[model samples]
Target: MGLGKQDRTKAREELAHDQERAERLPELLRSVAEAERALDEARERGALVEEVHEQGVRLDTALTEAMRAAYARERVLVGVGGYTDRIRRRKRLARPEIKQATQVAEHLLTVREAHRLHGIQQAPRSVV
Candidate 1:
């Protein structure tokens, strides 16, 4: 059977919420970019560990929100390959600044790639 009235209403509300988030995707991306930049600068400047951690947290939160919104819009899984391993490798190199910056940059790159892939997936396919 089809959805009942309450279920239909809930579905409609969810759809509308997703649509709103989709509309804000651009803004969210900008915020993520800004956060990434701030984190990178903090790391590069040899800021205190606590300061760098704060900036990293900000970037992480922004990336997470952006990904959530993108998923809501596209309903697809985006793979960021080997992120943990890459971070571990960087950490093992003993370059704290580079490791921190790389961690933030990697996340930002993954989010951008997710958006790009979603766009490609949503593109209209041609018929022969």
Candidate 2:
């Protein structure tokens, strides 16, 4: 027995919905890309490590949830078995860099202030 016309139409509509979501994949990927670039610049500029890590972790969590949602909606949206690892890697890669940079920047700022104070102390005392 063949699927009734109505059943075939329903299947077609479902496929169409899935395909539309697939079209939205590029936009979603672009969002992740923008976040990555901002993260890199933040690391280079000495943004707070714990804070950056928190944000990155949040993004990673969100992206994973998104991938999971898409997968549940359309399992073929991503490659078989490779869908869950991308965000995890991004999170791991970003945490260390931010931590290192923020620590270095904080140390440098402290050293600068110390040196500035020392220079002030050693300056010849002028008569009032």
TM-score of every model?
0.58, 0.39
Candidate 1 TM-score to native: 0.58
The per-model lDDT (C-alpha) reads 0.58, 0.48
List, in order, the clash count of every candidate structure.
0, 0
Which structure among the candidates has the greatest TM-score?
1
Q: In candidate 2, how many Å is residue 25 off?
A: 2.3
* TM-score for candidate 2: 0.39
lDDT by residue for model 1 (1-128), tens: 44467765665666667667756767888998898788788878887767766776676677777766665444211112122234544444455554543444456558656644441222234479
- In model 2, where do residues sit more than 4 Å from their true spots? 4-7, 61-128
Q: Write model 2 residue lDDT over 5-32, tens digit each, in one string.
A: 6765665665565556656555654664
